[model samples]
Target: MSAEFLAELATLTDPAGILTGAATDGYLLDQRRRFAGRALAVARPRDTAEVAAMLALCHRHRVAVVPQGGNTSLCGGATPDSSGQALLLSLERFHGIDDIDADNNTITVAAGATLASVQAAARSAGRLFPADWAAAASCQIGGALATNAGGINVLRYGNMRNLVLGLEVVLADGTIWNGLRGLRKDNTGYDLKQLFVGSEGTLGIITRAVLRLYPAPTAHATALVPVAGPQAALELLHELQAAAGDRITSFELISAPCMALLAQHFPALPQPFAPIPDWLVLIELADAGEDSALQDKLAEVLFAQGLDEALLAQHASQSRAFWELRESIPEAQRLEGVSIKHDISVPLSAIPDFIEQCGRALLAAYPTAQIIAFGHLGDGNLHYNIFLPDHSAGVYAEEEHINAIIYREVAERRGSFSAEHGIGQLKRGLMQHYRSPVELALMRQIKQALDPHNLMNPGKFLPD
Candidate 1:
């Protein structure tokens, strides 16, 4: 069966498209290297037609299809299972920026187009594609939309779901749904494009997208301010938002431990804080006018709020330097070693309480655990990670107990266990625990309706 499938797959695309044996090795491992799996072959479809045909063949063969984008899924959503019976559908070859409508403020791009490429294209067209993060250079548009990614700009521009105008998806049985309308207002029944967004490719494969763009902001202001604590940070955020309004672009919370990690790993990077405060907030503001005016407005707000020690960026280089520290955190943590990572979000008001309580609970359980809590404070999402003394895979042995303590706090405060990251294999079990039975049933029904054979990225997003 495998031989026949590979033969037909080889004919669908070029010989270079179908990968097997060692060639498929790279696609099997996830970004975190936490989940490793096997695939019968990695199929790189060049266009929507080829993707549909490949998926149609898989449907006919009753083979599971694991759709993958830039392979930057931190939750192992793209990696296949150990069965070696699934076909890994790679969208790498479908990368293309089809069109950029300056008037409409929309960009039509192929699924495999990287976030960085889209941003550059938008910039060239005098527009802005605001969906951005650390993996912008490599994470593809399809995966970003699939996961409904939220980045630094989410506070102002919204998540990937909000930015998407329409999508082109290839269903399980060769059905192509082209709803790619660049309309801002559509009073249509059932916004179907949304179902696939953040569905983690369980329903279908995203082929192309019509994404919303914004006017390019000429003015920019960035500042790294030291706060007394989470409460102080929250107060400052409110004060800045009140003064700057929608112009405030990013407000990231950085912990002292993160600062220490940066100093240890990235010693060459500028360390602004003398003793490193207990907490720091990296704030950025942008507008259409001049940078001096925006910088003055930001500086005035910080001064009014009594934060005199704010390290405000004076130039483009300084702004880049400030952003570099915030972006290099994940890599620094990786270099530090293995840890139990959680991407959780609560209400903006509950952040301080959540951090304080969760930290206390975690410490009580694991006395030696080092809490690395930092993320988008403006949106209440924190990449709260725990580095045990072991600093190895063995620390994962306590993941269940640690997760129970943290997730319980999150639940109590009406927060989410999974914030920006989608529930791949890693957090699928938590769904049954966190989500209500009715919600899970509805998801199952949708999956059943879309892919009755369970061939579209099986054992992901939804539990059996």
Candidate 2:
């Protein structure tokens, strides 16, 4: 970024000292503080029009602009490199509930609306906005859409890509793409809105969206079932899916190590099982119907099939307690310190085998490594992470060797190296190793076509 361009942007955004010391703040650092870079400046746009103007100016001057929604991206998507050429564009100020299309079963929201707020607004209107994330409280809608995020409810409602019906986006050259029609069915030339959904700010910045809604489910049935291993898990998943089918809102796989870690760190959480089983599958069933007998019947089936050796959490209060343990796995691991993480997905049929084989392979390679596995199993996604056996090795390592060990196995299984958490700066190398030559070249072509100057979040999610 040149001095002349910096002066123009500072004037346009009207930020507090953006031309000087603002870049020294935490805004430029990635989550986990693993990647930090010098941004030319951090520009906060108050609304869509200003965002458009900012992008337009950057385009004219050939300055690189990195579109950031909440600065809460887990994979370093929001951070710039050391070049200081990229301007971090934050849309957090453009927040407000635009309109509630209650009759249309849609909600129009600004890109900066937090996911938690959007969900709350839908709840107020007696509708369901099922998209959620652990970072829902902080992550903005545009970031969620940019990554096409999938969370706990993906088993029933699908990912963010399925939840969004329409979007209002600004193109690479600052041209508006107003395709925000809240219709369920519209047969047009191209479903152009989708092109920007998971483009990760490489293609364009999503400024607004029309989100799909469903009837709010008032009753829930949640449980934690202790099962043996992969085969048992497959059997249990089939049995539960057969019983509740779509009502099986979430079927998450939890490893014994996960529980042990929780017990070790989160001591307040009481153990639900006598002896920790090899794995546990936390299940939740919710319906828009009034009947609350789902939990009773679910507990009965687990007992009868011997699918679950032990059952935890029957009532809503108990259900919440059970969920707290599952949700705390990440936090507990964080408390333990940094670890190697792989957000991977294999076929649903291959989940148990994948887990068992992956575990065995890693144990064979790095015997002292502690494996932590848990995730949304219904969709075949797993948060398969590894912790160093000793405290000294937690954050730093000759980790490239271990990364190779895991990613190579994932590729062998024909699985996605990145299931939900995207290919932010950390996984760019892995993408090259996993993605084919033609596919990568095509992505480069798309980036070149849309962002010709390489000035829109370049050097991210793509090989440099």
Candidate 3:
């Protein structure tokens, strides 16, 4: 039966489309190299028709299908199970931009197109695709939309979910749903495209998307300010918003540990701070006029608030240097070695309390733990990670206990355990613990209604 399935799958696309044995090894391993699995074969479908045909064949054969885009999922969302009975579907072949409507300010692209590619296409057309992050160069549109990814710009443009106007998806049973409408206002009925936006490929495979774009910003201003603490950071955020309005695009919070990590691992990178302040806020503003005016407006606000130590960018290179410090943090952490990471969000007002209380609790439990807390404070999401005495995978033995302390604090503050990152296999178990019964029930019912056979990305997003 396995041989028969592979033979049939090869017929759906060219011989190069099917990968088996060691050729499928690369696709099996995840981004962080934490999770690895086995697959009967890796299927590279060239277009929506091929994807639909492959899914139809799998449906008939009762074979499991795990959809993967770019293989950059941080939570092992795209990895196949260990059973070796599943077919891994790679969307790499479905590349390129379909269309870019400058008048409508929208770009239609194949799901496999990298976020960077889409951004370039939009820029060439004199528009902006605001969904961005460190992984923009390699992370594909389908995975970004599937996870509803959030980035620094999320404070202004919102998440990938907000940028998407419509989607073209291939359902579990190989039915193509063409709902790629580019209208800004559509109040006809339930928005079906949303179901697949953050579904993590459990309900269907996102083949294409019509994403909303924005006017390119003509002016940009960036600055890095040392704050007393999270409370000071919060106060500064509001003050800047009041002065700059929606032009304030990013407001990132960086802990002292992050600066130390950068200094230790990325020594060549500019460390503008002296003696490493306990906290720092990197603020950016973008608008339609000249950058000098925007820069002056930002400087006036900071000086008025008595933030004399703020380092404002004088040119484009200086601005890039400020952002590089923020963007290079994850790599610095990776170089530092293994650590238990959490992507969480709470009410903006509760951030200061959450950081203080959560840090205190974690320290009490593990005295040697080095807490590295930082992220998009403007959007209430923080990539709070902890490094233990044992800088190895063995540290994961304490992950559950550590997560309990932090998640409990988040729960108490009405925050979320999973923020921008989707609940892939890594956090699926937490769903039962953190989510209410009714909410879980609704998700299960939706999964049942859509992929009744449970063949679509089996053992992910939803719990057993």
Predicted candidate 3 versus true structure: per-residue lDDT over 1-464, tens digit per residue: 99999888889999999999999999999998988999999999999999999999999999999999988898999999899999999999899799999999999999999999999999999999998899999999999999999999999999999999999999988999999999999999999999898899999999999999999999999999999999999999998889889999999999999999999999999999788999999999999999999999999999998999999999999999999999999999999999999999999999999999999999999999999999999999999999998678888999999999999999999899989989889999999988999999999999999999999998889888
Stretches of candidate 1 exceeding 4 Å from the true structure: none
Give the better candidate number (1 or 2) by lDDT.
1
lDDT for position 233 in model 1: 95
Pairs that collide in candidate 3 are none
lDDT of 2 by residue, 1-464 (tens): 37898878777755653544654477888877788888777788887777888888889988788888777777898888888877788888888999888888899999999999999999999999998767889999999999889999999999999999999998778888898899888997889888787788988889999999888887787777877776687788788888878888888889888999899999999788867877888888888664357767677768877754556455678887888888899999888877888899988887877777777888898888888889998898999888876644443664787777777777787999888888888888777778999998998898888888887788788877
Query: Each model's C-alpha lDDT?
Result: 0.95, 0.83, 0.95
**Candidate 3 wrong stretches, greater than 4 Å:** none
Clashing pairs in 1: none
lDDT of 3 at 268: 96
Model 3, residue 34: C-alpha shift (Å): 1.1
Instruction: Indicate whether candidate 2 or candidate 3 has the larger lDDT.
Output: 3
